[model samples]
Target: MIIGTVDCFPTKSTLSKLSINNSQNATGHWNSKIQFGHRTVNKQGSPLDFKLEQAIVSGERDDFVLITANFTVPPRSTLPVDYELIPGVGYYKLHKEPQDWHTARVICNKEGAHLAIINSHFELSVIKMLYNRDPKLHDFSYVGISDLQKHKTFVTIFDEPLNATGYTNWAPDQPNYDGNCVVVKRDGQLFDTQCNGRFPFFCEQTLGK
Candidate 1:
């Protein structure tokens, strides 16, 4: 039987007991702490979903024993469009309409996702390949990661460093001095642009069900 459930929410956190043992180490116990740096508990599988999972507790204690987790869900934006899986990371998709960076982010948030945060060359290449290339539309797409507040240091909506996953796909010595937001051209190259510049965009469902 299911001892606990995280339930449905934009973000979910759960605390569960998996075989508590109060007497396992009563005599030899010593206080300790564990730091798992950046960990993921349940990712719908999209690195772009970049919702960080944190463990509030993972060790045994005489008072109680449980596993605690946290999920940060974005607010409802729109019905989520279908997504293509990027393997163990998460899911990704591109929209048909062009919108400014801020607007595109809002759309993705409404749809239960966020503007795509490219985590690897493979995933970034996949997005470039799969994005629609209708001749009648613009040639750029908005991406989620940005250095809007401070140049040279980019971040996602959740405020995590852009390279938190140890991958970056900036195009050449791009992100010119004046721009803040990022846009991806058809050649899989990224360039920083004004937040109000209109463009189609990539979105990610992140890791989770």
Candidate 2:
């Protein structure tokens, strides 16, 4: 039911019953000067006739309805993202395309303040949903954090320490000796990979204002 435009006109009997004569205004707009039935009946018996004391053409009526309907839609309070959020860790999404770790980081950075950070098993569960359609389920996705510094053991998008003691859920052999960047795999597991290796990445951000 995709109705584009509809012109609602009063039935001939309705117009005759209303006894509207010379009801057309100078602007060629219909006017409901004549009253009949329980309500005023103009050439066009639009709801606006009751509101505006006028008879409008079909197009004007449609525009009025559209504007009214738009005003009725509840304002969206939250930001736009296609995934649910974990209470603390961050929002989780499955990687879809091949992207280098750096590019992935940028994508997440654009998403919000916190950037993409995965730390708990529950967060991983949400990431796994992205890989359900793919047969070759990978281990983790590329998060915003990386350990590019020679002295740093771990790095976060915020340039903070990985803080291995808290909110860290690295998989076995993760942050491998040669691997300098972190990415979350489709399986919700964190793994270290060459920073240049392209893979899908997820973005993270804080919820609400």
TM-score for candidate 2: 0.50
Per-residue C-alpha lDDT of model 2 across residues 1-209, encoded as one tens digit per residue: 22133334557553222333335556677543333332322232212212223333467346332211111111122334564445434445555677888777666555543346655556556556556767675444577677787633777766777774245766786656578888765545566778898776666554433
Residue 119 lDDT in candidate 1: 72
Best by TM-score: 1
lDDT of all predictions, in order shown? Answer: 0.65, 0.54
lDDT score, candidate 1: 0.65
Q: Number of clashing residue pairs in every model?
A: 17, 11
The alpha-carbon lDDT assigned to residue 197 of candidate 2 equals 88
Task: Find the 10 residues in a row with the least total lDDT in model 2.
Answer: 66-75
* Model 1, residue 150: C-alpha shift (Å): 2.3
TM-scores, each model vs. reference: 0.56, 0.50
Instruction: Give the candidate number with the greatest lDDT.
Output: 1
